[model samples]
Target: MRILLVGAGLSGAVIGRTLAQAGHDCHVIDSRDHAGGNCHTERDAATGVMMHVYGPHIFHTDDAEVWDYVNRFADFLPFQNRVKTTSRGAVYSLPVNLLTINQFFRRTLRPDEARAFLECQADTSIADPQNFEEQALRFVGPDLYEAFFKGYTEKQWGCDPRNLPASILRRLPVRFNYDDNYFFHRFQGMPREGYTAMIRAILDHPGIATDLNTPYDPAMAGQYDHVFWSGPLDGFFGYRLGRLGYRTLDFERFDYDGDYQGCAVMNYGDREVPYTRITEHKHFSPWETHERSVCYREFSRAAGPDDIPYYPIRLVREKALLEDYVRLAQATPGVTFVGRLGTYRYLDMDVTIREALDTGRDFLARAAQGRSPAAFVHAPL
Candidate 1:
């Protein structure tokens, strides 16, 4: 069968590769001149450092199958995301670990003591938290929330923390131990040749054909037996319902002769700083050495029609509108919504790849049984 994949990012590439191996003709298309979407990485001309063109993308997951799958294409190098945050004129370790807690309070406390201390600081009155702010206050109290989360959350989302859902904060872990590692995933690493090269390798197959700078037109869908829409869900329908809220990022690039931040990512917890974080690209690829450095100051704002959407702002109003679009997608035929933008949710690199693999396998199974795949393999809501 002939398949059309819109947006040649991880989702489309993995799914297309899967179908191609199954004796299906898969055509992958991307509007951008390059593939890999946000995970696109290229070497800096001046510094010779492998810069994360969009932003820093650390591949971390507990899924062994997903880890092995990525490793099959690129050499997986050991990489743990150790994040730092500057707040109120002081730098602190992220994830609000024991070291951060002790440093902020100007006291050395054991793990058990710190845990008890944190409980005391929390506002236990609010038993059931509704929003990000409340959840922060309930877990870490006002001081930690103001210093560590409040300003950063507001800057990242471009809204008050209360305006966001509680699930956002619930997903973030607060550590009582001194582990400064950002993620708890068992397998974490960066690709040796960069994400773009890895993606290229994924698309390098006889049954797979790729076209860069190729935008997906509605008419193109009619030419294929099936379509995988990895682009924005509302975009597929031309925003007929309404534009779902999304936050876009702007990266301000600058080059330095020496190491910039000494770390891959340094987030600014102060809203007054304008930009949320500063990323030193060289640190992302630690094995390589370069005297010259490249860095970016990342700024997040409400997405415009022309801007590249980053985070999905799934507030109450957006959820209602999303429901309307989901209904429309369900009624539509011969197209399946896949990945972050397609499903309209914030997805990690691992989750996106895992879903794409599952979606592809499901499609193959259904096709074998003389059936068409569903509009969504996984529920967006």
Candidate 2:
């Protein structure tokens, strides 16, 4: 079987490698010049500092199979992301932990008192929260919500929190403990050689051919026995239902001697501020020490035609638009939509790889029985 894998990201790479190893000729293509997609990393030519070109991606997952699978390609050093935030000229621990609560209120409340106080603070009227702002108010209260989430959420999504869905704020947690590990994933680490090396290893099979800076054409569908697409679902159909909502980021780079932000990520939650988060890339690689640190101030906005899409805005309107694309995808045969862009949801690198592995295995199983691979490995929209 000749397999055409679109987008050389983790999903595409995993699928291509799996099919190739199964004695199928696999051809992988990516619009970007690199293989890792948004997870691509490289060393700065001048300072030798490691750089995450699209943004910082910390590989963390609880799935043992996914963790071990990635470790086979590159060594991963244990890393716990301790995030921080600044608002109204004050700095606080992120994820709204015990330390943050104590510092923000200027009182050392015990765990019991803190819990009671928060319950009192939360808005009871917002029983059925509709949007991000309402959800924040119900979960945390006006002061904290305004200081921590309102502005930051608006900046991140390029819209008012009231207009955004409640689901967007659901991922954020208000911890009762002092632990500030950021993620609850069992396995959390940074790849020793960066993500690019890990992806390159995944697609290094002799039977897999990767063509960087190559675009996928609908006309080429007849040339391949099967296709695994990781590109934008709407893009596959030429945006017939209009481009689904996406948030893109712009990174402004800077260099400073010693630590810049004293942490990997620092959120500025004040509405007056333009950029949402400041990422000190040097902090990501704790193993290597550089006297001069490199940083990026991230500005999030609606994704334009030429911009790289980062976050998906799964609002009501976009969901409807996505449904139209999914219907079209179901009708279109010989192509399988996989990964974040194809499925129209945000996914960590670990989940993407795990799904790709499962997709590839299923594809091989279907082929062995003389059946066409699915139009979607996982449900889209």
Candidate 3:
């Protein structure tokens, strides 16, 4: 079988490798000059520091299969994400942990004391929360919400919290304990070399051929038995219906003599601050020592035509537009949509890999049975 895979990100690389290993000819293409999509990383020429060109991507997952799968391609260094945020004038721990709560209030409270204090502070008036603001008010109350989430949410999403969905805030936890590890996953680490190298290893199968800097042409689909598209859902159809909403990031890069910021990531919760967060690239790979450091200040805004789409804005309007694309995708034959952009959802590295693996296995199974697979392995709508 000849398979056409678009977008040489994790999804494309994983699927291409899986199909190639099964003796199928796979051709993977990416518009960018390099593979690994948003997870692309390379060493800085001047400083010799491993720089996460897009942003810092800390691999953390509870799935043992996904953990084992990535380890087969590249060596992973144990890494734990400890995020920090600055609100008003003081820096504090993220995820609203016990230390953060105590530091913000200027009080030393134990776990139980902190829990009870937060309960008292919570607004009892709101029985059922409607949006992000209401959820925060009901759980953490106005004072903590304003100090920690309000300004930050406004800056990050470029919208009022009241208009956003509550599910977004629900993803974050308000812990009563002092543990500040950003993610509660069994496996948390980063590739020692870089994501690009790991993906290159994945695509190195004998049956796989790769072409970078090649744009997708719909007519090419006729040449292959199957097509797996990991590009933007709207883009595949030439945006005939309308463009889906997405928030893209702009990074302002600067090099420093020594460590610029002590930590890897620092979020500015105050709306007055222009950039949302500052990431010291050298801190991402602490095992490597470098005299000079590289850092980026990230600014998020609405994605334009030429801008690279980062975060999908799945608000009311965008959701409706996505549904139209989903219907068109379902009607299209010999094509299957996969990954974050294809599904129009915010997915972590693990989920993307897991889904790709499953999609590839399903395709092989269907081929053996002499049957055509559905348009999507995981439904976008």
Candidate 4:
């Protein structure tokens, strides 16, 4: 079978590799000059530090299979994401941990005491929290919400927390203990070399042919047996209905002689701060040391026509539009929608890899059984 894999990110690379290994001729194409999509990384010519060009992407997953699969390509150094935030001229541990709670309130409270204290602070008026604001108020009360989440959420999504979904706040943790680790996943690390190198290795199979800086043309789909699209779902259909909403990022680069921020990531909780967070590239790879450091201050905003889409703002309007695209995708033949942009969801690296693997396996199995595969292995809707 001749398979065309669009977008040479993890999704396309993994799927292409799998199908190629199964004796299928796989052709991968990416509009960008490089592979790894948003997870693209390169070394700074000046500092010799591995720079996460787009933004910081820490590979944290609990799936053992996914962990082992990535390890086969590149060595992953043990890295924990310990994030800090600045609010009202004070610095505090992120995720609103026990230490953050104690420091913010200027009191020493034990686990039980802290839990009770937060409960007291929590608003009991709202029995059913509908939006992000209400969820934050109900979970951690007014003070903590305003200090940690409100401004940050507004800047990150470019909208008031009241307008956002409650599920967004659910992803953030408010620990009663002093554990400052951002993610609670079993496997957490950054690739020793970089994400691009790992992806390049994945696409190095004998049966796979890669074409960088090449955009997908509808005509090319006719030549292939199947198409696995990892690009934007709306883009595949030419955005006839409307472009789905997305929050894109802008990075402000700066250099420092030595340590900058002294941490991998630092969030600015105050609304006065323009950017969401500042990430030091050197801190991401603590194993290597450099005399100078490179950092980026990330600013989030609504994605324009030319801008790269980052977070999918799946509000009510966007969801309705996405459903229409999904219908079109299902009706369309010889194309399988895969990955974050294809599925029109905000997915982590592990989820993207796992789904891509599943798509590959299902396609091979169905073809062997003399049946056509579905448009989506895992339905976007």
Using lDDT, give the best candidate's number. Answer: 4
Predicted candidate 3 versus true structure: per-residue lDDT over 1-381, tens digit per residue? 899999999999999999999999999999899999999999889999998999999999999999999999999999988999888888999889999999888899999999899989999898989899999999998899998899888988999999999899998999999889999999999999999999999999899999999989989999999899999999999999989999999999999999887989999988899899999988889888999999999998989989999999999999999988999999999999999999999999999999999999999998889888878999987
RMSD of each: 0.8, 1.1, 0.8, 0.7
Model 1: worst 10 consecutive residues (lDDT sum): 163-172
Candidate 3 TM-score, true structure as reference: 0.99
Higher-lDDT candidate of 1 and 4? 4
Q: Is candidate 1 or candidate 3 better by lDDT?
A: 1
Question: How many clashes would you count in candidate 3?
Answer: 0
Q: What is the lDDT of residue 137 in candidate 1?
A: 93
Model 4: CA > 4 A from native: none
| Per-residue C-alpha lDDT of model 2 across residues 1-381, encoded as one tens digit per residue | 888999999999998988888999999999888999999999988777889988999989989999999989999998889999999999999899889889998879888888898889999998899988889889888989988998888888877788988887899998988989899999999998899999999999999999999998888778998888898988888887799989999999998988777899999999889999999998899999899988999999999988888898888899988888888888988999999999999998888988999999999998889887787878865
Give per-model TM-scores.
Answer: 0.99, 0.98, 0.99, 0.99
How accurate locally, in lDDT, is each candidate?
0.94, 0.90, 0.93, 0.94
Task: Compute the lDDT of residue 267 as modeled in candidate 4.
Answer: 97
